[model samples]
Target chain A: MFSNRRSDDVAAPRAGRPRSETARRAILDAAADLALAETCVPTIDAVAARAGVSRTTIYKWWPSSAAVLAEALLDRFHESIEFDDALPVRQALTGQVDALVRLLRQTPAGALLRQLLAAAASDERVARALLAQWMDPRRESAAHHVARGVAQGDLRADVDVELVVDALFAPVYHRLVWGHAPLDADLATRVCDLVWPGIAATEP
Target chain B: MFSNRRSDDVAAPRAGRPRSETARRAILDAAADLALAETCVPTIDAVAARAGVSRTTIYKWWPSSAAVLAEALLDRFHESIEFDDALPVRQALTGQVDALVRLLRQTPAGALLRQLLAAAASDERVARALLAQWMDPRRESAAHHVARGVAQGDLRADVDVELVVDALFAPVYHRLVWGHAPLDADLATRVCDLVWPGIAATEP
Candidate 1:
């Protein structure tokens, strides 16, 4: 789960017994499962009931339901996204996009992302956690990969890496929130093909 | 406001004079204004008080605050977006993007959009109304314009009109919901430039 941001700093030899890794896993699993249900974002009490843990234990770790579900989503997303550098830059971009589309299609993780998006719209703490702990980490890594293309002269050295990253990722996020368009591997491929020539150094 | 969807079908020629357009406008304005305030979405009682209309009058029209806000947001959005076909394809796209960015930065309309996004995430009715009444019509128009470029051989005829439209619009929406990046003309121009060559039939 992604809520580990401050855990490293604060967790060094905590005053009490080390937090139960088993309890944490139970809480996360229950939270993830509950989020997929046809209901509003799962309540903390509901999560506790599902996990068979006290409300105190869940609250002790996560500040809110969005935080718990975000971490749960990251658990799945982390396993799915694997970078493949052997392919050409365009293919590499498309491959990464392929993995991302899968992560979003899951009922639980997808719903969690939507809930976090709404929460982030209004709540700064939720916003920072999602951006810093989840999106930015992946985005920064993607930027670095893009910078490799620029450095190798595969891309125009002047190509804005940040903008390219947005070009690659924003449509997925946009479709996730709006529900107006299809979110699929084919759409991702089209996005890559259209964007590739713009950034490529040589004439298409 | 937007809740007018089924009302026209249901609210058949109500007694006590016809529904007042003046009262409707006041209700919508008050609803939009209250949404911008740092408060919960305006309640029927609150809106009625703010608009100086009876709660019965509000119930006679809008189903919810989000409905009124959606209509108000559309009012400004419709006036603001004017496409100019005289310009070339790329320039025309940029022109439309410029107007959209302006409408979103306004206090009331911008906040209403954010609130509605949150509402849409949780409520299917709100999502359907937003897509049906607000976004789809505009998106369908934008796709038509992109199709023009393809038909005229200005852009590669193979380009996907829907994907191009998504490329043109999604970054702005991504910025709106996430608040992670700047949403401005400069960003819009950069998006157009990156996407143009890939879609364009001719060399830069």
Candidate 2:
């Protein structure tokens, strides 16, 4: 399950005008567009101009251009992949991996992620914002799912849930960043099939 | 078993003077030092000056600063790891992972790698050079080792060696890039232990 809490909740309360969802949506949309098109991080001014909002309004809501872009990316990730706790554990894990592979390979979000990663390399603020707002939460969600599987006897109770989480998911990111291999459609299944036996509870 | 082939062998042979290994060492050493000391890609001019070689000399040997850095990195990787074909498959794989984790965590190579990754994001040349010269070769070597394991019946015959390579090694890279988890001393053993069950040949 994804968190409903807004990434911009940290914005200070202001008296003059209530924060506008319409304006916020516009800004985030513009930021996402700019990030997809540009190799460099989109500037606040560029985003404000594209969104047809004042720079003051942009800054009032988000601390930096990277923050805006991170939120936009987080929004897309949430929209693209939703955990189904109802499914069997293996199916659930494979589905999440499949969804993530599709999102990375089939969407503008992948290019945007590469750009964010590039920015994060130089900008500590970008790295922190991304970790805090997106990567950490996403990883924690997956970790929690793994822990539940262990608790339910679907996976080995002795397994380290966090390490299993990394083993299952990190290949996607590795291929994404390194480009040494392809993020093909079958990758999700291949990864899950290989990793499942390692974590799955064994027969006596 | 490691290839002794020099990464810089692709350098075009010139009519005038033979390529000096001492000068090449200086250039690569300077490039590595600058990469560790700074966030951005070190410039050809800076490397030339630091190595006490002419800009023309640097160009004669490498197409770009990235090429120099790539060769420098490849040199370090080769220096750091030497595979032992005599060891059992599991120990061999674990040793490779352990060496990589140490290289990434315990040396300036970690910072240098982060810089290369960041630069590779925008620079197609860097990506190509890294893939062709380093990532591809290193991966092929590991894949060969895995294939040998399968042939020896130490691992499941049905295992995809390439995917196995990715699963075993990608976590280190994922953590390195994303900083999602610690690259602790035990990570190599932990990863190998978890993944080994999935790949190991089982009795009837």
Q: Worst ten-residue run, lDDT, model 1 chain B?
A: B1-10
lDDT of 1 by residue, A106-159 (tens): 445666778787888788878876775567756765776688788777889899
Q: In lDDT terms, how accurate is model 1?
A: 0.72
Q: What is the lDDT of residue B152 in candidate 2?
A: 94
Pairs clashing within candidate 1: none
What local lDDT score does residue A182 receive in model 2, on the 0 to 100 scale? 88
Could you tell me which residue pairs clash in candidate 2? B1-B83
lDDT of model 2 at position A120 = 82
DockQ of each: 0.73, 0.76
Stretches off by above 4 angstroms in model 2 are: A7-18, A37-40, B7-19, B36-40
Which regions in candidate 1 have their CA more than 4 angstroms from the true location?
Answer: A1-26, A37-40, A46-61, B1-30, B33-41, B45-62
In model 2, what lDDT does residue A151 have?
A: 84
Q: What are the fnat scores of the candidates, in the order listed? A: 0.81, 0.66
Residues A114-187, candidate 2: write the lDDT tens digits.
Answer: 77777787788778777776687677767777888988899988988778888988899889888988899899
